[model samples]
Target: MSYFLLFVLAGFIAQLVDGAIGMAYGIINTTLLLSLGIPPVVASASIHVAEVFTTGISGLSHAFFKNIHRQLLIYLAVPGVVGAVTGAFVLAHLSERFAKTCIVIYLTLMGLFILYKAIRMKSTAKAAVTFKKSRIIPLGLLGGFFDVAAGGGWGPIVTPSLIASGIEPRYAVGSTNFAEFFVALFSTIVFILILGISVTSWQIFVGLLVGGAIAAPLSAYVARSIPRKIFTFIIAIAVILLSLRMMVKLIFF
Candidate 1:
């Protein structure tokens, strides 16, 4: 298949999952593109470009029915953007294998954490709760660091963490989507300025935007009524599957 076709397929699949779960576009897209021999930096940059449009569309759709916490967005995005920029540069010089390894390990741990949280939350019959500012900052920092390092793992980490901290699932998802807009914008610009543009990157970007736009409204509808435990379980499963896929590639391929 042509590389363009590959990118389109990757984008479609990634955005479908992303729309349903609140984040996965970068994680899935980057991993697939890297497997196709794309450099980690290029893959990361391309995903960011696509994510800008995807997240914007999804965020707007989510806003129609969800409460977005602007204050939380500001607090989280500041550190996320900084961390993403640093990660993009670091990725530019790292070996793809090493980057993949790091991503696999991180995702695995994060997936397990989310899974555990989901199980605990399920038993309680209430979403986990928290309002501590101290908790938010540190979690945001960690989410930002991983997001940049692994090419957009922040959504999975931040969304669940926020939900666990007592925020409603709909709002947490919306807030994460809102914060992602700036993160992708800043990361894309940095990558473009540093790495130069290419046809492949543009193809992936367009595909992601298109797919995300199509899925956003549908996802918003579902997000409104989906139970917190179910949502957490679904996202956790996705993270675990993606993490395992990455690890398999690292180990045997």
Candidate 2:
């Protein structure tokens, strides 16, 4: 029961950041779950299943804020959805132990990557490189694949990459969050197909829903002046620590 409440709190905090900044939910959830020794595909499947609902709430909120770029959303979503199916299928076939180790490594790297981006976002860095709009799909495909492949990559890859490509921050966040719905939705289907259907746990599913629902509307209405510097730093540290702990266990025992 205590662990369940902690899980709910984790979901609440993860969703709050994700709703506001458009990233971290998947990575954060993945890092924490993996540290607890949950199987990789099971963790990914559970999070994606939860995200199907959370991202929907988030998408509607972003839309209400008028923060989305419709063209970009479509371009990203179409390819992302396709990549998600492929990635989910591939991962579902992996042995649990091997998959768990690989995910810890990948997610640890992403923690550093996200930390760097968070600092950049905090510092008001300007994007010097701008890509043609047509360049969007390629990255979207990769983001989609990695998102399900490692349990989360859509926002971490797409949101900052889009901003770095000279897309506006809010729009990039908004569009990425919007497109993630399809990514999670289709990915969940593929996971169900490959692994067979199981709820994983209703407590977790409901916890995510409750947290995301509370945060989504609040984020959309007041998406400004979040203390990115400190919040993101803490998130970065948490990801690194959790991931490293498991890596050490695998290496030693």
Candidate 3:
């Protein structure tokens, strides 16, 4: 009962951050579950399952707030589903150490890139790097793959890249959160096939689902209401801190 309530709190906090900034729910949830002695693959599987509900609610909230870019959401969703299925298969059969390392490095670099862009967004400089639509396919693929393989990375990989490409922070966040629903659904399906749908603790699932559901609309409101400059800075700092934290955990823990 205590752990269940703790997970409720964890889920609320994780979803709050994820909904507002477009990342970290999986990382946060999975870390807590792992500390409770769940296996890595199972932890990832459980979180993805829980995400099915959270992301769905979150997607609807973003839509309600008019934060999503429809075309961008479509482009991200299809390839992301494909990549997530593939990643789920790979995680079931293979070692993810190398893949996780590469993803962590990529996240760190992207975080820095976003921080630079945030700085530029604050300045009067006309210099900008536009994000080409052509990049969406590959970005979706990679983002989906690493998200499952590393336990949580879709927002970390996709949102900042989109924002750096000069997309508005709100749309990037909203679309990414929306697309993640599909990614999580497909990934959860694949995991259920391979790992059979039982989480280490039912509490983890229910707590996260209920809590995340509660936060979904509120976080979407945050994304919609926050100033672009502040939102961008928050994203930059979140990515940097999350990537660095992942680095430290990977090396020391």
Candidate 4:
């Protein structure tokens, strides 16, 4: 019961960040799960599975608001699923501690990258709407791989990169969230085949589902008011702090 509430809170916060800054749902939620002693593979599988439901709500919310990029969604979905499946399968065979460390490191770097985007990069919003649909193949492949590898990345890697390259925030967030649904759905199937589903914590799964669903519409509402840089900074700080906590625990214990 206590854990259920805890995960609900985690999911709310995770989705808020993802909705606002276009990233961090998987990394944030998985960090909490890992801290609770969940195995690395189990953590990723559970997160990806839970994300399918959450992302569906998010995608719809974004779509209704016309936040998605049609071409970008096309570029991301197919390769994203392929990479997600491969990553899930590979994760199933990895050593827990090693995978945990790698995930934490990956998250830490993502946070820092967010900061770089916020502080260093100039806004390209003037031309952001007509971004060049460049490098979709390699970017989608690698983004999908790292997303499941760390239990999240499609947004962190793809969103800022697209934004920096002149894609607008709403489109980046919406399309990525939309594409994440398919990536998570397919990756979840792969995880079930490779690792089975008996290990997942249903209590936490339900908690995340409900919490994320609640946050979905709220995030879209909040996003309309907040500037993209401000949201990115908030996400960067949250992820950096959580990632440091995970790293500290691993190192000291």
The TM-score leader among the candidates is 3
Error of model 1, residue 212, in angstroms: 1.6
Candidates 2 and 4 compared: the better one by lDDT is 4
List, residue by residue over 97-216, the lDDT tens digit for candidate 2: 575576567557767775776677745544333456578898788788877776566776676566545555667677888899999888878767766865677766777677777777
Residue-level lDDT of model 1, residues 26-69, one tens digit each, is 76787788888988766766777778888888778777876466
Find the 10 residues in a row with the least total lDDT in model 2. Answer: 222-231
lDDT of 4 by residue, 1-253 (tens): 5878887888888887787667779778887888988788666656767789999898888887778878888888888888888777787676656756875776688678767777865544343566544687666776787777655567766766565554556677788888888888887777677556543677778888888998988776665556766655665676677678768978999
Write the candidate numbers in order of decreasing TM-score. Answer: 3, 1, 4, 2
Pairs that collide, model 3: none
Residue 171 displacement (Å), model 1: 2.8
Cα lDDT, all candidates: 0.72, 0.72, 0.84, 0.74
Give the higher-TM-score candidate: 2 or 3: 3
For residue 1, model 1's alpha carbon misses the true position, in angstroms, by 12
The candidate that wins on lDDT is: 3
CA shift of 153, model 4, Å: 2.3
TM-score of each: 0.78, 0.72, 0.90, 0.77
What TM value does model 2 have? Answer: 0.72
TM-score of 1: 0.78
**Lowest summed lDDT window (length 10), candidate 4:** 123-132
**Per-residue lDDT value at 61 in model 4:** 85
Question: What is the per-residue lDDT of model 3 for residues 20-79, given as tens digits with 9 covering 90 to 100?
Answer: 999989878877778877678666656777899999999999999999988889889999
